[model samples]
Target: MSAIRSATVSDLEPLSQLLDDYRRFYAQPSDPAAARAFLAQRLGAADSRLLVHAGQAGALSGFVQLYPVLSTVSLAPRWLLNDLYVHPEARGRGIGRALMQAAATLAREHGVPRLTLSTQTHNKAAQALYESLGWQRNDAFHGYTLTLD
Candidate 1:
């Protein structure tokens, strides 16, 4: 299994490529420049935590991006695992699992009470991976999103 570590600014170029691929997987248009800019802003602002797995030749094979969230009811910090992606060629090599484990470790290190993530209902592969890692499906609450654009 490849070692998972925190992403640095030096990883921007390859990380952006991975981010673009991730967006494309979700049916988004390919826009490398936009992906780079978005990741740049996140890294610069220190608003999100990015964990990456390096593949052969030091290329990033997978990544997980977590955003901090405050739970009012719990009065504690939590993480919203907004993005997790493994290169198609790198799948099944345990990179995704490593990334998720690393994310959980990081969250625990920061005293976060919990970590949360959502995947499309049709993404059975991802759902299985997450469940295997002990992530439970939230049956108690429904998630609703308001898109204003």
Candidate 2:
């Protein structure tokens, strides 16, 4: 089934739900309303691009969101694959790979020099998929996070 496409405002509901599920996967509390508003804000600002995967029966099974970034050394634009989520039911069907490829294509078309993403270290499945798609794991630099609140 043709399942992937650039998401539009028409996909807001499903996209919001999927995003909330993604947050929950990271141990965040469920907040569907917050998810909706967040996505709406992002879409309205045009600061990011979201691609959706509509599985069987037009269900919104997965999505990937990209944000633009710049490589200081290269002095070229790049893409940060900020979020990627495929519903549990949609796993193992190559949707994730397809979405990654689509994101790469979009970046390349826009003259982006590279695309980058970071997944939880424990997410072996995602690592495998990314490695299989030629994504090199960054072993050179340590990643750090700081909580603002």
Off by over 4 Å in 1: none
Error in Å for residue 135 of model 1: 0.7
Provide the clashing-pair count of each candidate structure: 0, 0
Error of 2 at 113 (Å): 1.2
Error of 2 at 41 (Å): 0.7
lDDT tens digits by residue: candidate 1, 85-128:
99999998888988999999999999997999999999999999
Best by lDDT: 1
TM-score of each: 0.97, 0.96
Clashes in model 2: which pairs? none
TM-score top scorer: 1
Candidate 2 to native Cα RMSD, angstroms: 1.0
Tell me the spans in candidate 2 whose CA falls farther than 4 Å from its real position. Answer: none
